[model samples]
Target: MDGPFANRGRRWPNVTVAIIALWTCASPALSQQVSLPPPLASNHATDPPLAEAMQRIEQLEQTVFELQQRQNGGLIEAEAPICFDAPTAELPTHYPIYDSGWTLRPYDAAKTPFELTIGLHNQFRYTGFSRDEATTIDAAGNVNTIPNRNDFDVNRGRLVFSGYALDKDLGFYANIDYSTVASSSIQPLLGWISFRHNDALTLYMGLGKVPGTWEWQQTSRYTMGADRTLATTFFRPSITAGMWGIGKLGDSLSYTVFVGNGLNTLTLRSSDLDTNFVYSALAWWEPLGEFGVGFSDQEHHDNLAIRVGHGLTQTKNDSTSTDQSGAEQTVVRLSDGTRLVEPNALAPGVTVNAFDVWLYTAHLGLKKQGYSFSSEVFMRWLRNIEGTGGTSLESLLDNGFYIQGGAFVIPKKLELFVRGSAVTGDFGTGSEVAAGLNWHLFDKRSARFTLDVTDIRDSPAEQSRTGYVAGESGTLLRAQLWTFF
Candidate 1:
């Protein structure tokens, strides 16, 4: 028993089908002229109307099939049979859409005034740190010290909120960090508002990272090791409130320029910021295409990829209004880990209150298959020392370099690396040797377990990330579970 919509292809002619198609496209009213039968199941086999409608549907299908055949592999969709349990309620005009990736976004384009995307990152760690003597003497005869640690903690946990409003090209970002080092402290890590003029330019202002070195710019979640190299910690600038210009010249060339308050002005009031400004910039070219935003050959590039970059920072530092004990913001320190602001730091009876600083950096990176290599060199010059009391001073020069390479012994699953760095300056010298491994859990960099062992001698860098205490000789062991949600 054939229904009204059964196949009856040979009854329809080509010319008649063309005319009907044209009439349907003329307007909505004309398009609905050919009515389709409804409310009849195929089991209504004895109904005359059902049989007629079935014949009309078969003719339509043949016409559509002929049109589709004229194109190569193109599809013309036909009416679909509704599911038996499908909901009959119509969709609302404005409904919230949910999306998830590294971040979770929930908003509606029609009803919401703005968009909001939330992201989270957690790094849990087991740090086993030991130092030789746990104390050392600085160039100025001041004793520096650090405590040994064997601890389990959430080293860094971050919550981020960001999205666009008013204009699609205008955006805002905020990152809150819960740091467990020193003491459990919650702080606002980054906050910025940006306007993108086009693909080539974006301008932002607020508190964010000042453009520094290539490794310093890489997202913390993607470092080649559990932390950055010691040399980077020794010379890199600190986060500050500032404005920046970030842009891409083309697919391979990119740059960032920033002007901000003195380095590590996090604890400083606006009144404490002097008229002088800290300025820095970096630009890199990936001649062989994207070298990736982070270290490692995680993507396993089949061809050679290379990137070279140069950066410079210039500033006049005045210690008059700064807190002498802000450990993270003490950007200019003697190689022996003596703060430049300390009285009699360079000579007896002389105190350094102000100084001029200029830093230059160059770096290169290469990646291919399951291997990668990267290195950077730095040069620093300090002059124009201003102090209380008559003082005779000479220019201070510091230089250092770090080289690191890695290979994926098991492709994306397991990787191992070795790194070495040193610092040479007017007061003293420091060096570090380290080896590390990353086990990408489930082959995802977004979730990985990292392990690293490092030996240090008179380390010039002092940062909590690597648990490097200034002016100390020590060995460190770290194991971390890093994940992004």
Candidate 2:
């Protein structure tokens, strides 16, 4: 289709017809014009027919000589312009880049500046719960009840669409999840339009995850357990409409800072939100190379690797609180599982309406051979309490921590892990210990089966998704098969 002289013959038909007009008689080739013998040539260039034909032949030879000279001069002046293939130029074509792993550019991106990628994450779970007691008391002197469950569930059937437009640095993302546990059967989660200046910095706007803790920083698809830890659910910030900045200072250091509408306004309308905004920031460093997102030693590092991180978040808002666990549940909870929104929660007759909260957290993680160890600590300070009924309230403080470790029993395929966590606050103290086994179906953790059993006492965490029931001691069991693409 393309060659230096591919057009060499395309421009000659018109030039040949002009040469015929110059001749009194029709002749398509110069050889025919020159075939007339000298016998036909007479005095003064012979007969009129012969003389005219000779003149035309001479002109044609000159034209041929000029074209040859032009070709030698490196210019094809009569050639037609080059063009794209007709079929591809008019029709759009696409094929999967991998149909697995990270979705990369697969839309014949060089020809089209816009790209759209689709992804999925599926998790099927089986859980069993048994409470030590039917009812338990909280710091507020209120009795709370527990419910037991044994069944199967889905996360449920999450779908993600993300890509870039105009430029690779301009990106967009949208996620939808359908599950019975969600506030609605189908709900939109995080969605954003982002500008990535470089690996060192990226800015995003829209409903996004607040950057407040290490556990929440990594994707849920790569969790070391079937789900995040109970302590993480208790201390971490929830999804909110916000703008955030994320960047890496160097090969080992990364950071994120966010400002959002409220601590837990995922389902709230603008009228329901307060005037105050929540601010959260976090930074982590992996000194010995990349410490991958997951806590599990799936990599089986030949040498030691470590990561350290710190985070802080502050918020003061007039958000309604609830003891129930749902898609948009209240984030600020008492150690003994009492909702700050509960009437007379802090005093005999006062109803607390709002509070200012500050949380500081730190974490350390280590990996070597086929083993991994990680831990995080959280401290919270709540002040500026607002209430009804003219009852004065005092500040409150709370603290919590979780430690986890794992080692592969069969190279990279099977792993044994143990985890424990505890919480202490003005209201009460609670804790849990758990053990699990993981069997990776593929080389990556993208496909896996996990099983774990946890024993909890006066559980402070109230996240039902993580199998925690506040104010009630219990033995919980979970098994899940999860995959991502």
Task: Extract clashing residue pairs from model 2.
Answer: none
Q: On a 0 to 1 TM-score scale, where does candidate 1 land against the true structure?
A: 0.78
Q: What is candidate 1's local distance difference test score?
A: 0.75
The model with the greatest TM-score is 2
lDDT of 2 at 228: 81
**TM per prediction:** 0.78, 0.79
Which tens-of-lDDT digit does each residue in 1-485 have in candidate 2? Answer: 56865433642443344454344123323323333222222342534654575565555544443333333333333342322223223333333454453454534456566767788888888988898799987656778878887989885467888989877789999989877566577889889999999999899999988877788777876667788887887788888999999999978999999999877787888766667888999999999998776898788899999999999999885534441222232567888878776665677766677678898999999988889999999998888776764344799999999999999989889999999888898888888889999999986787889999988888878774566777878898999998888
lDDT of 1 by residue, 1-485 (tens): 37753533433343354455444333323332454233233433564754575555555544433333322122222232212132222212222333332322222344434667777889999988788886787878877776788998777898988887766678999998897873437988889999999868899999988767777888778888888888888888878899998999988899999999867776567766666788999999999988886778988999999999999988886555532322332557778778776767888867776678888999999999979999999998888876665353788999999999999999888999999999998888999999999999888777989999999898888877667778878888989999886
- Clash counts for all predictions: 6, 0
